[model samples]
Target: MLALDFINIGNGDCILIREMEGTRQKFALMVDFGHDCLVRDDHPGELDPRSQRIYAGDFLRELGVTHLDVALATHFHRDHIGGLGRVLDAVTIDRFYTTYLPPENAPELDPFHPDNNLPKAARSALLCLQIFTEALQSHPGRIKQFELVPGTETISLQLTPDLKMDILCGEPALYRRQKEIYDAAFNGERNGYELVRWAKSMNVCSLRQRLYYHGKEIVLGGDAYAHVWETVNLTPCDILKVPHHASFDSTS
Candidate 1:
């Protein structure tokens, strides 16, 4: 049986997927871990009292899951990967996947930088990437493998005899284009407003994933925007994790 747990993490996303044989979990995968605040006791968001909120790591421990077969971070948004540091502290991941892997020579855009006047969205993205990078570095030995989901082709993996997963979207070209704009702005060649505009529209580069269990199909749309769907091939699915929290710009 295939079990999917969509954990309640306020405004973020945390999904756990497991394939079970009777009561034993044969395989396990996690998509995102939600924001860091959700794992903290002093979370400021007014959550529904009846709905219990738990950190991704705690939730895994409660379910007796110690090692994840695979973990995918669809994008660098805080709402999707902020709590990953906490999760890494609690569980061992066998393989880690992401849409973009920062180049080793990437510029340092920290607060101390002379031209660190990035807009809110750009700053937030940088922070999220920094946190994720730190988390991975902290547990280098724990995670056995790391890979980047390719933008040019779909990667199909056979999870089990009856289960499979397809990495459907990853646009390194789009990411590079935006990075160039970001770099120009940081170097004073372009205005900060241009970087802000690009940041707001960067959701188009988020990854889109699809899973097949038996004959049923489930689509995990990450934060992809409407225009992204127009370019990719998406089939009918039994369940769809609506993109961008089902915002006005989510659907095609």
Candidate 2:
């Protein structure tokens, strides 16, 4: 048996998957866990320091999950990765999956670039990304532990013979395109103004994946845009977790 639980973590995307081999045991996989609005000035600010630490932590503990077989952060945007630090602190994750093109693959960034003034949302997202990256880097062994969820790859869960996950899209081509454009812009060959917009376009870089059990299919599109979908190899699916929260850009 397989089950999916869509968590209510305010404005963020969080889904829990359970694959059971028999009535006795099951495995867990969590996808995304942060809110873009939560880290902003608009945050309710109701939770004290103690409560803050235990907010998402308690929720996971209540699920009776001692360890996660896999944890996936589709992109680097805060709404997807913000609460990850807390999640990491609360659970033992065997493997963490993601698709953000690292610094080496992309052009160097100037946080205060005159032509690329980042707004409040981008700044907050960057902060959350830094925190999560720093945490992973501090532990030398963990730096190599992260696995990049490749595009068009299918992964099978060991717990259930009939369960498999397919990555329908994760554009290495887009990463390469971004790298080329940003590299040229920084080198004075193109408009630097476009860099800021490119930075935020990482949403299109999301690694959309699908779960298959028997014949049922569920497509999990994480903030991916229409352009990304157009270039991807896809088939009809039973259910789709709408992309970009069903925003116009994703649907169109």
* TM-score, predicted candidate 2 vs. hidden true structure: 0.73
Query: What is the C-alpha lDDT profile of model 1 across 1-252, one tens digit per residue?
Result: 999999877668899999998989999999988887754434665656687888788888889898999999877777888889888878888888876655444444462345666666666655666666667666667778888665667889897888899987656687566566645533445355765666675677777789999899999989998888887666789999999899998996
Residue 109's lDDT within candidate 1 is 48
Kindly give the stretch of ten consecutive residues in candidate 1 with the minimal lDDT sum.
103-112
Best by TM-score: 1
Local distance difference test, per candidate?
0.77, 0.64
Model 1 pairs whose backbones collide: none
